[model samples]
Target chain A: MRKLPELNAAGNKIPNRQAICETLMEAAGRDRNVVALCSDSRGSASMTPFFEAFPEQSIEVGIAEQNLVGISAGLAKCGKKPYAFSPACFLSTRSYEQAKIDCAYSDTNVKLIGISGGVSYGALGMSHHSAQDIAAMSAIPNMRVYLPSDRHQTRKLIEALLEDEKCAYVRVGRNPVEDIYSEDDCPFEMDRATILADSEEYDAAIIACGEMVRPAVEAAKLLKNDGIRAAVVDMYCVKPIDREAVLTAARRAKLIVTAEEHAPFGGLGSMVSQIAAAECPRRVINLALPDAPVVTGNSREVFETYGLNAAGIAAAVRGAEEFL
Target chain B: MADHDRTDNVMKDHKMTNSELALLSCRLREQTVDVITGAKTGHIGGDMSVMDILVMLYFRHMNISPANMDDPDRDKFVLSKGHSVESYYTVLAEKGFFDFEAYKNSFSRYGSEFIGHPHNTIPGVEMNSGSLGHGLPVCVGMALAGKMDGAPYRVFTVMGDGELAEGSVWEGAMAAGHYHLDNLCAVVDRNGLQISGRTEDVMSHEPLADRFAAFGWHVIECDGHDMDSLDAAFREAEAFRGMPSVVIAHTVKGCGSSVMEDKAAWHHKVPNAEEAAQIRADLEERKEACRHA
Candidate 1:
């Protein structure tokens, strides 16, 4: 197993979006068919390294998201693996029809990379936040939805997507996140849950995805310190979810708590709840944002305010203890 | 080469004189009505209006056939005004993309491969386009990819004047002109009518040529129903260089039949048996006239 990079002495972590750029550059370097198209978001999407490294493979589509997806579909139709990148907020809503017909319905090999997913845009408010992206993308027929937890998972997800010619919508946060796995977890598989913390017996299970996984893992440790041995599972593959894993957790643990950086409806929570209710009915606590627009603040502040951090998840576990 | 043999094989027997092309257009119109009436679903007015352009592109000019369908350098034709697919499908069948009888038998049937829209599942169909404003951007992508590969293929898309209301059309137009995609050509079936009413009454898209020209495209105008005029416009568009070209072909809604001509009611309205018989007689009469002329 290769060793994972250490956290920065100051900021404490590296942005996962950066790993996407580096890994894509490496992939494009190896395979000439791999291409990347950006909608006037090369800088924000961390695509500069790819643009500079392989100038021929990079495409700039101006600020038109509709054209971006359309052009990528065209490229895919011609037997090229094109990854279209833009802000998640606009890409999901602005060019949705193009994504649906050109990419998904046509069965084109276009990888739609939604950058700055969730509230990673900080105080930019609802317009820039992509809290509703998962619901829209997962609803599409041929689309596979994935949200990687950290840098390690992001690299693996890109590799997996490029290995096949499937339509996928991969959402990545704009900011750096703490590492959930080291070099030992080098190889990763999608549509499968990664169990971070496990025990023979537990009070409950905290299932999280994307950036929320770090805090869920932290909350598990915090709960252990309080004599509550809770299991932490990272459900990164939002669609084609690991139903068996969720059923196992629901059977073993008396309670199931889903955490995500998205709206409480039609997201990780809704998916897990639906599975748990049908297979093994139990009390499922959804730790997610409200239906309305999120309040304006930095991502960390917004997360802390909404009890999405480690302490809040730990507190939710304690709150659910009574139900167990 | 095998590619040369394929193009020659498809074009040899089907290559028609101007009068023969006109006769074939009338035949295609009759077949389109039959399919739509049989399926009980289609956009009849736009299909008749766009039939000449489809025949001109498929049977006459565009270097495409089922033999070279997968060739990377084969010219691409995208039906941006995809709802008018009755005409597009007829032309494709005439060009030997698929058996015309099979298409006629299965169109709009439940679980049949032939759907109402131009799906890529059909051989020789480039992009799946039914929603307006999607075809041009996709053509732009294909054209740009050709440029990147230095391939000699040209990309063409045909849209309706009513489809101009979509803002994405201009966005794609802006990109095509900005990139100076000379290998790309677009045609607008200027039938002057949409589903609701006249294009101008629904939303004024006048100075349409100026609008496209302002976007850095070389614009051309022609009588859409006139085969010679359309041939000249397409020839001029192909000869031009350094910018994308758009040929705005003026046409009447439901061009061939007396009752349907210039009528907006025929937009997506399938003809009943009586009306379908009249349309068939009208096209056959035109075909007989062309046979002598």
Candidate 2:
């Protein structure tokens, strides 16, 4: 297995949304069939640069998310690769049926890029946070749900989507996140999860997805110095999840910890536990945003308060001793 | 291209008069009514209402047939008012898109792909649409794709009058207008009734032409049951450019038979044995009348 990147001394933080825009712009420039659509969310999605650069390739559908999905499906039917950008809060709900029927059921090649997912809007309140996108989008049969960990993985995911003709929902956080992998360090796979840290034997297994990956990596480092070993797996592909990785982690660790910036039910934790329980039957600890309208704060404060940070995850692993 | 030697090559060199098209629609309606009766269920009322328009688009004007199904530049049509699929299936089979006998035997049967809604898996159909207010947006997408490819394909969809109540319909309308998609054309089956009641009572979509016109479409109103009027309306829509065009086809909910005409109660109810016989007799009577006229 390849060595994990230097998580402690990472480079600058880059917004995953910006990474999507840059990658999509590059793809669209190379092929006019690659098109980007925004539902009045070009600025928030970091797609304004793409829109200005490729005027013809960029489609602005005003503020309607349903039209955004429907038109993208139509464009795909006629051989154009459409990347539909919209806020996750509305894109996963308001256009849920369209995504289910028009894109997935119809089997159109539409890539739905949901921006500001999982409380990325933070103080914007419950209305803007898309805590249920994973569950909602994951429920569709032909629909593949993904929440990439950082800018590097986000680029790889978008570029991968442009090559295939299938329906997908991709969620990215709003703010810049600490780099988990350098420009050349990120070795990518389409649906399989990538392991950041794996040990022959460990006291606890830490599994994380999307933005929660960085914190899990940090938590692993914190445990390493304390003579506690951990296996950290980034299960980025939430649907068609890496069951092998989950079972492997179950075999290596005394207990399993799954972290995510989503609600407890129907998220990464739920999927991990189901996989682990069927084969290994290990104790699974889910560290996630509680089921409630979270109080107002920035994303960092929310993560800290909800115990979704490095310290919180490390503490959860150590606290597993009470069960053992 | 062996399919090019189809028996129903009526559109190749024959320019059918309005009455001849009407007679043909009545003859096809006989088969449609039989299928609905055999299937024991279908949206028969709307099927009757939109038969004339379907007949004209398939037989006289549109550049589509079994031969050009593989042609990317061929004209595309979507049945947005997909509940009226019985009429659509009849027309498609008549045009040799598929075997009418095969479709008739297994339509809406157990494990049949030929269900009440339009399924694209069946050859000659474009999008799958039983859901209200989805087909127009897809048509807009196809039209935009044609423009981008510089293909000569014309994209068309038929939406029900009652389907206008869906908010997504307006969203699609707004986008179609904004794009100024002249290659895109939409026809509203302006039948007076829906499942619940009259469209005016269930939802006020009155001034239908004005509604589409306000959405940046060049609106054309026509007699839905008259092939000549529908043909003329389509030509006018095709002639206009710089913005999408819409045809508001005025029609009765149940058109062919006196027992079903203008009645919302017949929206989806299967005709009884007596009613089915009466409807078939009425369609045959109309066909005989047309043959003499």
Candidate 3:
């Protein structure tokens, strides 16, 4: 893959969604079988480059999400690797039945890409937010769910997904993200978690996925400065989650804190908590959005207000010490 | 001239005449009723309504069989109305795709491959469909795949009139039209009644043919129960090119049985032993009449 644009003059990284377009364009160029289907959100789904580069391989299904998924499943059955891209809210809720029966139960090789997941649409309100996508996607059998932390991970995940044939849902936020990895090549696997921070002894372990991974890694660094020494693990692949990674973190850390930009009930927090409850039984606190509608703001603003940013996570982890 | 006559003879040997096929339809109804009665749970009304259409597809039209099921060049059929699976299963059995006795005995029993809906596990079934509005879209995909591979295989699917109300069906219709999938043929089992009421009373699809035509499909309206009409419609569909085809097969719910025809209660109701016997006698009488006629 070509090198991503240099970080802004300030040296801050750009969003990961662009990496999705870049990687998909490269994939379409390399593999003729790799096709992309969009529901009139080709621009928003960041698939313009792939559309321009490989018009023959991409399908524009207008505004129909159900047909987007059903047709993708059909193409998959016909021996094509299809990625059905739409905003997470509609892709997970409107076409949910098609995703469940056509793609998952029918055992087709369609990859469902839920763009702008987890309040990434920000001011567009709850109607646009996709906080429950992980919940809806995780419940379906034979569906693999993942959320890459940044551009590097997004590139690796897309490459791996194209090579394998299975039903999958990958959620990516709308905007650029802080770089978590310096290079595209990393120790990435479809079913394993990546440990961003390691510690011999830890006061708490922060497990996170998708947009939350950067803040989680930041929290770990801050906790270390405060002498708390929290270990941060990127639980990118949510379904068939790395249970062994959770157990390892739980054994070393005094407390386990699971964070995600999703509902408190399901998603990364819930999956990790379930593993901790049944196997390790540590003091587990899930940092996630509440059941009520999320407050309207930009993604950074919402995240900051809800204790999801680096400072918020560090404080939450430090405060959980009293409970422990 | 001799070679052509020999080829014609071989074709005639494999293809059942319309009269013979009509008689076979009655026998299939008997077996369908037996399986549903044995299971004590199945969609009988729509099954009888769509039985003749299924016979035309599996027995005569579709280029599929147990031996050629795995061949990509073979035609594909999806039972989109999946609830009418009783008739589909019976027809597949009659086609030698599987054993009728084995399927009839184990249907709907815990773990039987012959569950309530048509699934790929069955030898000749293409896609697992019981949910309405799914099969057509999948067939469109298959047909598109055929066009892409430059393979000479056609795709077919059947849906119930009640199932036409689903929004996804229209979405698939729009896509099939936009893509101009000429290799695809869909048949709507227009049996008038749904569980709640008549299809027109429930959701008037009165301009159904026009609707499909507007969506770029070549539409054919025909009597679903008339074996000749269905055969002719499918033949026309096979010959048509440039756009997808949809045969609007108007039918009576529970057509073969005296007590069940046009009744919504029989939509999924299983017949009791007495009613089953009566239906069997009715089919036997129909078979006798066809023999004499």
lDDT (10s digit) by residue, model 1, range B1-293: 34345345545745687777888999999998889988999999999999999888887778888888878878888999999888898998988889988999899898999999999899878888899999999988888887788777778999999999998898899989998998899999999999898899999998999999999999999999988999899878876889999999999999899869988888879887888888888888888888898
Off by over 4 Å in 2: A8-11, A322-324, B1-16
Predicted candidate 2 versus true structure: per-residue lDDT over B81-149, tens digit per residue? 999999899999998889998999899999998988888888888778888988887888888888778
The TM-score that candidate 3 achieves is: 0.95
DockQ of 1: 0.76
Q: On a 0 to 100 scale, what is the lDDT of residue A165 in model 3?
A: 88
Q: At residue B225, what lDDT does model 3 achieve?
A: 84
DockQ of each: 0.76, 0.70, 0.63
DockQ of 3: 0.63
After TM-score superposition, the amount by which residue A86's alpha carbon in candidate 3 deviates from its true location, in angstroms, is: 0.7
Candidate 3: tens digits of C-alpha lDDT, residues A248-318:
88887889888899988888888888888898888888889878788889999999888998998998888
Clashing pairs in 2: none
The predicted structure with the larger TM-score, 1 or 3, is 1
Interface RMSD of each: 1.0, 1.0, 1.3
Most DockQ-accurate candidate: 1
Assess each prediction's global lDDT (C-alpha) against the native.
0.87, 0.87, 0.85
